[model samples]
Target chain A: MAGLTKQEGLSSPVSVSGLSYAYPAARGGNSRLALNHLSFDVSAGEMFGVLGPNGGGKSTLFKILATLLRPGSGRVRLFGQDTQAARGTRKRMGVVFQNPSLDLRLTCEENLLYQGRLYGLSGRDLARRVDDALGLYRLEDRRRDWAGSLSGGLRRRLELAKGLIHDPDLLLLDEPTVGLDPGARKELWDHLGRIRGSRKITILLTTHLMDEAERCDRLMLLHEGRLTAEGTPEVLKGEIGGDVITLETEQPDTLLAGVRERFQAEAARLGEHVRIERKQGHSFIPQLVEAFPGLIRSVHLSKPTLEDVFIHHTGRGFWNEGAQQESRGT
Target chain B: MRAIAALWSRELLRFFRDRARVVGALAPPVVFWFLIGSGLGNAFKMPGAAAGVDFLQYFFSGTLVLIVLFTSVFATISIIEDRREGFLQAVLVAPITRLSIVLGKVLGAATVGLIQGSFFLVLTPLSGIDLPLQGFLWAATAMALASLGLTGLGFCIAWKMDSTQGFHAVMNLFLIPMWMLSGALFPHSTAPGWLRFVMSANPVSYAVSALQHSFGMGSVALASLPLCLLVLTGFSVATLGACVWLARDQD
Candidate 1:
């Protein structure tokens, strides 16, 4: 319900006010609002994350900020300038899309060089920058090799290098680690952290990964085309005020009734599991198991994650990869 | 302008790098020209009948038109896939204008078509059609003009299409007939009344006529060299204008 629109300076790296977007109707279906009255601001030199389930409007917001889609209502301002006339500000923002945008047939070096030239960077300066990008991403050895020949992890690193070869002030990433191994994802984050450390760059990346969201300086949770919650990960986790208890049971309805009657804690059924939130949730587990006899199958207790934060703000559980194969933004 | 040149160069780089695609696209025309020209040797009387010209000699210009069509048109087909999932989104978000992007891509494909045309031009002796230096230069110029116009036309068709299957469908529905009716297989005098009328409306017919004129067989075509040049230039400008218009979310 709380949204920031008319805050301070419009010159912030990214500022959205009353933003809403509706994809045009299918032949028989009515139009659906992909984003509804969303408002937020990402300050300079901050790593911000938008975490959401698929169809939660992460990509719609991304497209608007990246200047790919024109907003249906409200405004997206990049560095004090409206995105309508994004020509000047577009030079300041570099976007790494969810899709692999590299020309696989072109050499790693040529891909970077061509990206530089698109931004009107050329000659020896562009060449030197390409070299620096190669050295920075450790792609120097693969400079002459075809991009398609590189592994997914190496290709992603090369993609990051290409995105930064122009040295833009703001970097926008959409699901930056969509198809990478855990180690590769960690490597990418390290590189991103290194970029932020060495330069005055503001990064805004969207993801469904809870740990990835935790790495961000500040975060926003989106569900069903609305902003459910927004704050630092720590603060958002603190909103739940204690630990989260997830109990897997064959009959969640009966367990939910008994747990609430016996424990006097916030309890709800999430899919096939009973989730309870209370202070000292770990201690409640032994009592919960003792009361239930042979009813409880499994119990998981942990600090509230971004996923729990999403569930805390919205009763619906987060959609995993199996639940949402492709986002509605597509 | 530099951005446009970079995109243009990238297109050429990708085209040459795909060895299988390059060989696949360039080889068919040679076989078509050789098999058809030899199999149907100088049987039919020349439509204009100036002298002892064989079917191989008459079909040389037609073969040239085929090469230009196949190479350049196929080049623009890459756009549909790029627009759907890949490299083009990066180009769209870049600081460059949409017009420059269209010009860059169309001109790149046009250049590829020109190269293929010139490659075929080198083997004019195999067809036993001896062209002097003046004829060769004129033929090259005509090829360049045809390549530009057709590639622009291809860009126009492929720009808004999301699927290459749809593009191929459009190609089969429209482009193949345009090539067939351009007097590539048979001359104007040989066609029936309605067929000639349709061929008269086809712009590629003008390109074919221009190429025939460049081959020193101007009488084989209905139009003169200057008229063909004017038509080809007009077609190039019109199609390029359409592509730029489509590339723009708004004009």
Candidate 2:
């Protein structure tokens, strides 16, 4: 099957700078900005991950790239063509939305055929392309099955295949694997990894999973519509510059006050534990042990994680949603 | 042409797939053709009306027009489903021209409308209404054009509406009243003056009137000819234009 020629490589990195957006909401008849000067660049052929809490504008940014929602004020270029223009920009990109887009009534093969024909392919050419996509996604066996009848993982894989059916240069995925079992999620990730190796399809995926974010070549941490940090996973962890000292104590508040007073250390609480950032965890342990001897039942020293990196950068967990104070109380 | 064929084929495939949908598309025209035609055929008072003609003969056009109207309006459900399922987005992102996309689906749905409208043509003889070969051809042409017009209107409405409930409500508010006022099931002379004006302005009324004329019924309303033809032509252009405009920004 003939796909887009490699000689037609991506032009340059997608760039967005000084972009601001706001949704009009009636609150005493007032509107608020959802995003403020959100600027970030995605280099071509790189797996770029955007990590953020729920309602933190991650999906909003994805929508902007997908061209589903217009940014109130911003410049968005796809392969250097203005997205708002619609004609030249669409040929370069493929988008798989968060909502399921597959036609459940049609068989998987038929759905792909219909989508391919929309892009001006037909007869033998269309059939060959469909076969290629089906084989690539490992869905050749179940190509005759209805899309709605497939498991969530299979459906998601099909969605990816459908999006790529036109052989687009860029793939924009909005929470593609939002709800899948662990085994299925792992399997889907493997398929994703395989595709990335085979094709230079530039992928920009929005994910809330810390582990998934760590797998990306580069990660952008977005907090409340703002870019807090951008770098490789290791570099992001290195930015924190210290080991994490976690204190598991029954009386965390009392122990925290005493530790602050004696050791002059600040800590962030997570459930029943308090994670403190310190240069030397081993050296600080004895001092902490002596001061809060009985209260500090156990002390664990761990390397900084992507979750920790996000927390350090955004001062919040990746799963945290600001509106639910009661949820955070847990 | 290929895009239109693909879209139209998809609609036909979808229409035949659901048993209930097919039955729903055919039921109204068939039932109304018999009931209203029989009632009016017995009580009609037009002195110079064709002899041996049952009310079903005069009502056949209206019933067929109803089929076109119902099929066109309900086909909007496909749009809602496509939007909900994300299938529409897949089509929108393709490299084909946007007008082909709208034209394809509209023509596809209209094919079903034409088929259902033609079904009533078969029952016309059974309803005691004479069906000549020329009558069938003319009526078929009228139904096809009316279905095309209605499908175009449906496509335009579906483009702007995102929710199924809203789509249904608009269909009910816009189409149901227009169908009732169009002299489809009843004679326009019996309707109130305001309704007569509405029927005069209604494109469906002209469509049904044109179909009725094809069946060798009463004199053609000359004043309505230009008005109906203009609305049909103008709305098709305007709605299609709107569809193309909306299609461009489809991310």
Mind sharing the TM-score for model 2?
0.90
Q: For model 1, name the residue pairs that clash.
A: none
Instruction: Please write out the lDDT profile of model 2 over residues B171-235, one tens digit for every residue.
Output: 88898888877767666766678888888778788787776666666453323444555666665
Across residues B140-184, which tens digit of lDDT does each residue of candidate 1 receive? Answer: 888888888889889989988899999999889988889989988
True contacts kept of each: 0.75, 0.61
Candidate 2 lDDT for residue A295:
90
| Per-prediction TM-score to the true structure, in the order listed | 0.92, 0.90
Predicted structure with the largest TM-score when compared to the true one: 1
Off by over 4 Å in 2: A1-10, A27-29, A249-257, A269-273, A321-330, B1-4, B43-53, B128-134, B220-231, B242-251
Candidate 2 chain A, which ten residues in sequence have the lowest lDDT sum?
A321-330
Clashes of each: 0, 1
Worst 10 residues of 1 chain A by lDDT: A321-330
Q: Score the docking of each candidate (DockQ).
A: 0.63, 0.57
